[model samples]
Target: MNKTISIIGSGFSALSASCYLAKAGHKVSIYEKNDAVGGRARQLIKDGFTFDIGPSWYWMPDVFEKFFNDFGKSTSDYYQLDKLSPAYKIFFSDDVITIGDHMDQICEEFERIEKGSSKPLRAFIARAQEHYDIAINKVVLKPGISPFELVTKETVTRIDRFFKTISTEVRKKFKNPKLISTLEFPVLFLGAKPSQTPSFYSFMNFADFGLGTWHPKGGMYEIIKAMKTLALSLGV
Candidate 1:
């Protein structure tokens, strides 16, 4: 039987869900308040210059690739990606720390800051990856209808670690405040202070170092166009 689904918003997550559902033979309807699609990924055009109003930064390029690949396509087919140099600039009291645009370079930078830090950084990222798996599989995708859905003996063991303060973890792991701040800033993206954010989000650290930073050549609107194309092709 074909399921009928209505998705609100045309943002990345909404569109992505719509695409997969539609492709799975569902009759999909997307209700977007705005006249155009893309939601937060919408583009802004000005005097011969175009800009992206929100989500100016890009990370986790592979996630984007995976989305496109699911439909027998790749992001390259829709838009060109350029890895940003010095991924971003960080300002601090005494110095400016520039995170590299690549993994090897980031490791080298870490090595310079603290001896034997690079390997620990890699291990930390691995742990974060494990936590990310649990999050995606056990929690995030769940509807959370009951306490039991979110709590269990196994989850109890994991939840404590996730409840710890990000500041305490960062302070304990690395001495470089700049790196710590740079790494921790992503907590804010999820709408929480580092101290308030669950340690589970440390996966963002893995996302930061491992995937590398990227940007579409023209603007993030390129991604929106690609998603719209995919949605239409899927008969959404």
Candidate 2:
């Protein structure tokens, strides 16, 4: 039996949900409080220049690719993605450091700052990559409505990581404060300090230097545009 579904916002999450629900034979209607469809990703035009109100960083490009692929569409079909080299810059009170998009150059940067640290950094990222695979391929796909949703065998074995902090994990691998800060920056994307976020979430580091940063040809709004387009095409 088909049921009517009302989603309160038309952001990415809401739009994505509406697509799935509408496709599943539900009558889905998205209600947006704002004039625009995209909540935070909405673009503002001033003085003939475009500016995005929030979220410019495209940290996990693969996640976006996977989302579009699930809808029988590719990210390329909507907007072009450009990978940023020297992905980002961090400014300290004393100096500034550039983070390269690729692992090789990023590891080289680590070697330059703290000699012999690159090898351990590689090992650190390897563990982070493993965590990334587990979290992205398994954990994220599960609905969060039930505790049983997270009680899978893989998460059970990796349970120890949830008790540790990203700060602890980074400090265990690198003695240099700079190196530690660089590793911890990705954790901040969760809006939590390193000491507050779980070590298992260090997969963010892989999402950073490993997967690299990216941007659509136009701006972050392009992704919202694509998602909204997909939802509309699905008869949501």
Candidate 3:
């Protein structure tokens, strides 16, 4: 039986849910408190200039591709994505760290920071890639209704990652404070300090150096617009 579903917001998650529900043969509607969708990924226009108010960097392109793929669509169907070459730069009191778009470039940058650092950097990112495989392919797909949802074979073998912190993991491998800060930067996307975020979240490192940084032709809000368009097409 079909049911009427009223979603409370039109953020990315809400818009995505509405599309899924509507596709499942439910009547769905979205209620937004603001004048537009996009939630925190909204746009701000002023003085002949437009700016993305939040989430400018586009990481994990595969995740976005997967989301659109589910609807028989591709991100290119809506907007263009440009990978940033020298992805970004971090300025310290004495030095600047430029994060590159690929592993070889990033490894070279690590060697520049401290001699012999690139070897451990490679090993660390290798482990982070493994975590990424488990996380994006398995863990995140769960409903999250029970703790046991996390007890899968892959996660169980790497259970210590949950108890440890990103800070601990990075500090153990890299001694240079700048390098440590560069490594821990990705954890900030989780909205927590490195010392507080789980080491399992080093998957973000893979998302960073592994997948590389990207930008939608317009802005991050382009994704919101894409989701909104998809939701509307699904009769939301």
Candidate 4:
């Protein structure tokens, strides 16, 4: 027997749920309060210049790719992704530096900006990659219903990371203020200060420098578009 599923919000998570439920022999319907869907990710078109009005950066391309893959579709089927060469640029009082897409270029930039900094940057990224892999591949699947869901061997071994903040960790690793600030910026996504945000969340740096930043030509809204299309295709 098929069950009827109603998704309350039309945000990314809601749309993704609809697609999954619809594909699982269920009737899925989305109820969005706003006139337009996508919640915060919705676009605003005006004066011949389109505006995303929401998220501009697309982190974790692998996550998006996995979402499409689960639905027997590829992200390329919806929209093309072009990896940004300089992942992003930082403008300071006297100069601007663009973080490059490739690690070599990024390391070179670090070396030029701060002598002997590239080696530590490389080491930091290597450890961050481990955290990234464990968090994404292992921890993300945990159900929030139980605290035990977080009590894995990996989490047990890395328990100390939770107590330390990103700022503390980065400051201990790198001495350059510019580098430390740049590294801290990604943790801002957690809605807390890097000094307050846990070092465990530094996987975001991996998401930044390790995985690299990307844009889906149209806008970040393309992810919502793809999820909506997938839901409809699944007969939601």
Candidate 5:
């Protein structure tokens, strides 16, 4: 059934929601406070260089693929992704570590730095993947209307795993301060200190060091262009 839906923002979330809603036969219109769309994903042009002011990193390819797959398309149809080599550079005090392109190489590097640490790193990654799986599949996808919305028995059991601070959990696993700091740096990108962000966010490290980073061929702004085309194709 086609229903009228009014989305109040022009951010990626709003644009993505509009695309899927429109694809599902909803009459969708997006109202934005800003003159241009893309909200935080807004584009900035300077000195012949363009930048996506926010979310420049395309971290979770699988999530994007699943969203595109929902509309009977793959991400490749909209944009090509080139995996970043060395993934990203990490700075720790006076030391620099460039995380490599492959998971086995990353693990080898981790083990080389801190002996007997690879197993814990693997375990941490496994738990982080579990958190990501649960978050996208069961929690984040839902509109949390209340605390009760997340209080099922399964969620109750799993809640403790996410309750600890990422810093605390990472410290509990890795004894090397530099390695711990390198792993925790990305947590700051979540808009919170590691001590405040939930441990589930370690999945970022899973996506970062494990899954690797990617960029659209043209530029990050290309994502906005692709999304605009997608929204227009869905009849706005």
Candidate 6:
């Protein structure tokens, strides 16, 4: 049955929901409190310079590809994406750490910080990759209507991860303060301290070094614009 649906925001998640709902034969309308529809992913322009107000890095390209593929389109149809080499640099008082685009380079960088650290880094990322598979492919797909949605053969085996903190996990393997800080940095994106964030979220590390970072031709706003365009095409 077709029904009129009003969404409260025009963020990426809201816009995505509106598109899916509209495609399912519903009338969807998005309301944005801000002047633009990108929500936190909005752009800021000053003089002749443009800046992405939020979420500058483009990780998990597969997820973005999956979203676009559902609409019979590809990301290239909307914006060009380029992978970043030496993805980013971390600055400390007396030292600097550069995160490379791939695991090999990242491993080498880790070795420079602490001898024999790359071996453990590889093992750590290997576990993170497994978590990535389960979290992204299985856990995220669940409807989240019940806690039982998280109970599965894969999750059952790794129940300890949910109880452990990323800080603990990183500290257990790495002794250098700089190296520990570097490993735990990724989970900060979850808006939680490393000591509070679950070790399971180390999958973020895999998302970083495994998938590599990317950027759109213009800015991160291009993705929002693309999603908005897709939503409108679906009659949202």
Between candidates 5 and 6, which one is better according to TM-score? 6
> Per-residue lDDT tens digits of candidate 5, residues 1-236?
68999999888888898998998899999999976788888888789987778787888888888877887878888888999888887776677777889867778888878998879988888888877776667776677787676665656787776678899998999999878887787776678799888887777777777678899897676676677778888987
Model 6: per-residue Cα lDDT over 1-236, one tens digit each? 78999999898899989988988999999999999998888999999999999998799999999999988999999999999998999999999999998888998988998999999999999999999999988888777899998899999999999999999999999999999988898887878899999899999999998998899999999999999999989988
In model 2, the runs with Cα more than 4 Å from the true position are none
Better candidate number, 1 or 6, judged by lDDT:
6
Candidate 3 yields a Cα-based lDDT of: 0.91
Question: What TM-score would every model get versus the actual structure?
Answer: 0.83, 0.96, 0.97, 0.96, 0.88, 0.96
Question: What pairs collide in candidate 2?
Answer: none
Candidates 3 and 4 compared: the better one by TM-score is 3
Report the C-alpha lDDT of model 2 over 1-236, residue by residue, as the tens digit: 99999999877899889988988989989999988888877889889999988788898888888888888899999999999988998898987778897888898888888999999989888989999999888888888788788777888899998999999988988998988889988887788899989899989989997899998999999989998899889888
Please list the residue runs of candidate 1 whose C-alpha ends up more than 4 Å from where it truly belongs after superposition.
3-5, 111-120, 133-159
Query: lDDT value for candidate 5?
Result: 0.81
Best first by TM-score, ranked: 3, 6, 2, 4, 5, 1
In model 2, state the lDDT of residue 22.
Answer: 83
Segments of candidate 5 deviating more than 4 angstroms: 1-3, 32-36
If candidate 6 were superposed on the true structure by all CA atoms, what would the RMSD be? 1.1
lDDT of 1 by residue, 16-94 (tens): 8899899889999999998888887887778988888778878778778877988999999999999888788777777
| Model 6 misplaced stretches (Cα beyond 4 Å) | none
Candidate 3 Cα misplacement greater than 4 A, ranges: none
What lDDT score belongs to each candidate, Candidate 1 first? 0.80, 0.88, 0.91, 0.88, 0.81, 0.92
lDDT of 5 at 86: 80
How many pairs of residues collide in model 5? 0
Model 4, span 1-236: residue lDDT tens: 89987889899989988888887899989999888889999999899988898888888999888988998899999998999988889999977778999889889888877899888888888888888888888888666788788778887899999999889989997888988888899978767899898788889999999889899988888888888888888898
- In TM-score terms, candidate 4 sits at 0.96
